[model samples]
Target: MGKKETIRKKSPPPTNQPVKDVYPTPPPLPVKAPNNGRKNGSTTTGNNCASTTTKDLWDDLFDGGYRADVTIKTDNGDIIYAHANVLGMASPVLRGMLKRAKGCGEKKPISIHGVHQDAVRVFIRFLYSSCYENEEMKEFVVPLLVLSHAYNVPRLKRVVEVELEHGLLNTENVVDIFQLSLLCNAPRLTLISHRMILKNFKAVVATKGWSSMRNSHPGLEKELLESVIEEENNQKEKIRKSKEQKIYLELFEAMEALVHICRDGCRTIGPHDKDFTQNQAPCKYRACKGLELLVRHFAGCKLRVPGGCIHCKRMWRLLELHSRLCADSKVCRVPLCRNFKEKIRKQSKKDEIKWKLLVKKILRTKRIRGSVSFLVSSNSISS
Candidate 1:
């Protein structure tokens, strides 16, 4: 004994039918015209009720009843009824087809292939009414996108792209959608799908769709791999720039602290006029306390030669920077400021350019930090 095949009923001529078909590849059945016995161009509601809005009129037209002028045949021979003018106005590609078919005095059925009949029904529904059920959209979005693209329906294409970008896109189907986006020339969808692939590379590459695409489309596979590498390199570059920015910001803060200490001093270090023995309140500058310790170290370190000690070399560099930045180098309280100014004149052109570049970076960093107030005014370099 064999199980009997289920014969599903066709969609009735009505407004807003629930989209519940499971899209099984049912065997082709005999085609029959809908039996709504009404004359063409008549949309009488029979109850004498008025349609309150344009949407209601469009809905009535989409219901087709007996007014549809043409039929659309789907991949599995399921027939959908629609108006010629509606389809013509909504899509230029369809208009062209309809124009070429004008010689056939009677309208012939327009055949749409490569997708399920249920999807074709939804596509036709949207063309007439600019409306669709959520369930139908969820089930037939990809097919709808393809139909929209093929038929040159930009509005429907845009809507489908948004739907895919916001809700339908996932790692399991992203690779397929990415390829579709390229085929359809949807730049936004392409960008979004590409980002999803890059962000979830392992999961996306593991999907069956990606596996199929890899086997059949080696060029695309190579392109995606190159993009992944480029994305990684871009991330590395961002990290490097962030680290460099941090160093420049620190140097900027250190420069500010150096000027503050030289002019007003911290709790334990200052010029001849400033007191060094008073138990002053904690320094307001965040870097001042650290710079005070380094100053004390620089004053007492025995290995103060150019290459002798790292700490002294750091102090020497700071002092040299201050000299380059100071307008009144001769009277600047910072030790070696005058000496560095004199010695800078004898430096090689390469060394001078390097120091000038460093100085520019520090000044640029300071300018970027517009909120930081200066602590000293005398002889500071004009930026």
Candidate 2:
């Protein structure tokens, strides 16, 4: 009747309990990376005193600071100022001026004479900056150079000379530059000018500067002509030596090839073929340079032919060339030529006579050597 119709009072529908709500976690915000271009060693602040350890400190320190100690008065009445330590470091003359001047405590301004105000300013700036302004300032280089020599500034003088030599070097101005170089005692520049004048001697002589120098500088023109003559002689000597060397190399190659053919011979070109006695076969190896002409001349060369074959003549010439090229003849490979050398030394024979004697001796030696080889072969065959 209710199987316990007492539905237990239905348990109040199990007291409807509230369920907790769930939410998804938001994706982590994308993390930003720092820029790579930030200088790692650099640190800075708005206040100048807070910065430290910069990459090139002297530039910023010498640029425009609150620590300048003295003023410079130039010949043109322009005034500039700089620190005493910088001036002292730049020139011994400046150091001495500071040391000797009295009645002042680092406030005295030094007066510079014989130099343009613009040049003096550039000089002082170079002392601090190690280099001056733009190309517009090139006009001041000569005046700066003069100032550098007067003040014993070697580094600045060298820089000025390089600028003049490279940047200002032209036919129109080279003579002036050369004169300035000579006056400044610049040896490298003087030598360079001398060579330049020699190279364009005609054009240089036609210039107004050369006309002025001719009236003033005497030994220089003579020196230039002598240098030109010496150069011509040197070139002639070089050409002669080069020709001699080329002929010598050709002779050596020909001798080596001839010896090879005389001995065992080659597969392509050997003495067994009658081609050795023919003079008209163009070579396939060394272009059309008469390389095959000597083979016919060497096959049956005779020592008693009253003169000699082309091969014997070349061999004789080779010996003579060896005597000339060799620095020391005491230990020469051409022992017979060494005796020939002694004979010539003793009797002082003419070159033509000595050459004929050399040819004869070479032919005689070939005959003797051939006979000895033939006799040896015959004896061996009989045994």
Candidate 3:
């Protein structure tokens, strides 16, 4: 009876009761993540964590919103940018320079704003840590030279000058380096370099003479010699036309005086002169002796027999003797004869004008003889 009463009391559940679906809600539609791809307040948490993880990294990289360390990566390699602080530097200017340097990558990997990689690296290291010294400076010498010229780095240029001074003193590299010094407009460097170059005058004259001749045009050569002469002449000239004319006259007089002095001192002495002793004073009285000595001492000039006239009796005597001794010998064949003959031929050619005139006279005589022979043969045929 109690169970039946409980059943009667349990009426139908309320028709408007909420139904519980088996499928769960779709996670609030994922909140459609923000365009920044971050959850709200997530970055704040991350920022805090990152700051804690790497303290002072940003501070070290940037000072008061200005970056001091510039990172540059190129195809060749990585380069760090730095500069010297002579005085207070402007942040904007520094930033501009950095930007310009970075923009240089458009043309090539190793160039920054037309500055070469070697130069840029040297400049960067110099600016950043002042690390160039001794051996390191030597490694950077060539690049620094280019950089110094490009950027007008006076101090760096001086360093290059010092290196060149040391290098030019070497006998092996003197001539080429002297030319380079002159081309670069280093006057002091040229003086040292010239000394080295002049040490090998004969070698330079024999091997490099053509190039030197080409470099000095007729006008320039004349002007140079004239200037030397003018320097020797200290006499004042009458002012007939202008100061320029007087200067010219003075220069001419100086040049004449110099020539006279040179002729008296150098040209008068013979090879067998009493004062001319190779051991005592080899170059004392010879015109070309000084040049020869200079060339041999520094330029490693080969010892060659002195050239002489082929038509001279001495030369003919030597040839006759050689021919008599070696004519029938197979060992002294075409090559050996040709070598000796060539020496004679070159000596003959030294007086090319005289040889040519002699040859022409012989040809004319031969033509006259040929005509006379023809006439005699005609008369004989007729008889």
Among these predictions, the greatest TM-score belongs to 1
Question: What's the ranking of the predictions by lDDT, best on top?
Answer: 1, 2, 3
Q: After superposition, how far is residue 212 of candidate 3 from its true place, in Å?
A: 13
- The number of residue pairs in model 1 that clash at the backbone is 0
TM per candidate comes to: 0.77, 0.54, 0.29
**Candidate closer to the true structure by TM-score (higher is better), 1 or 2:** 1
Q: After superposition, how far is residue 128 of candidate 2 from its true place, in Å?
A: 1.1
Candidate 3 segments exceeding 4 Å error: 1-78, 83-120, 128-131, 167-176, 202-383
What's the lDDT for residue 305 in model 2? Answer: 34
Off by over 4 Å in 1: 1-57, 100-107, 276-282, 371-383
Q: lDDT, candidate 1, residue 265? A: 77
> Which scores better on TM-score, 2 or 3?
2
Summarize candidate 2's per-residue lDDT along 193-226 as a digit string, tens digits.
Answer: 7778767778887888877777888676667678
Better of 1 and 3 by lDDT: 1
Per-residue lDDT of 131 in model 2: 53
- Candidate lDDT values, in order: 0.77, 0.59, 0.41
lDDT, candidate 2, equals 0.59
TM-score for candidate 1, residues paired by index: 0.77
- Separate clash counts for every candidate: 0, 1, 2
Give a tens-digit lDDT track for model 1, residues 1-383. Answer: 79999999976645564455434567899554432332122234465333234444676777753577777777777778778898889888878777766424556467788999999877877776566667787788888889999998887887787778778888988898899999999999999999999999999888999999989998999999999999999999999977877787787678778877887777767877887766667777788877888888988999988779899889888888777777776666767778888899899989888987887776676667665334334345433
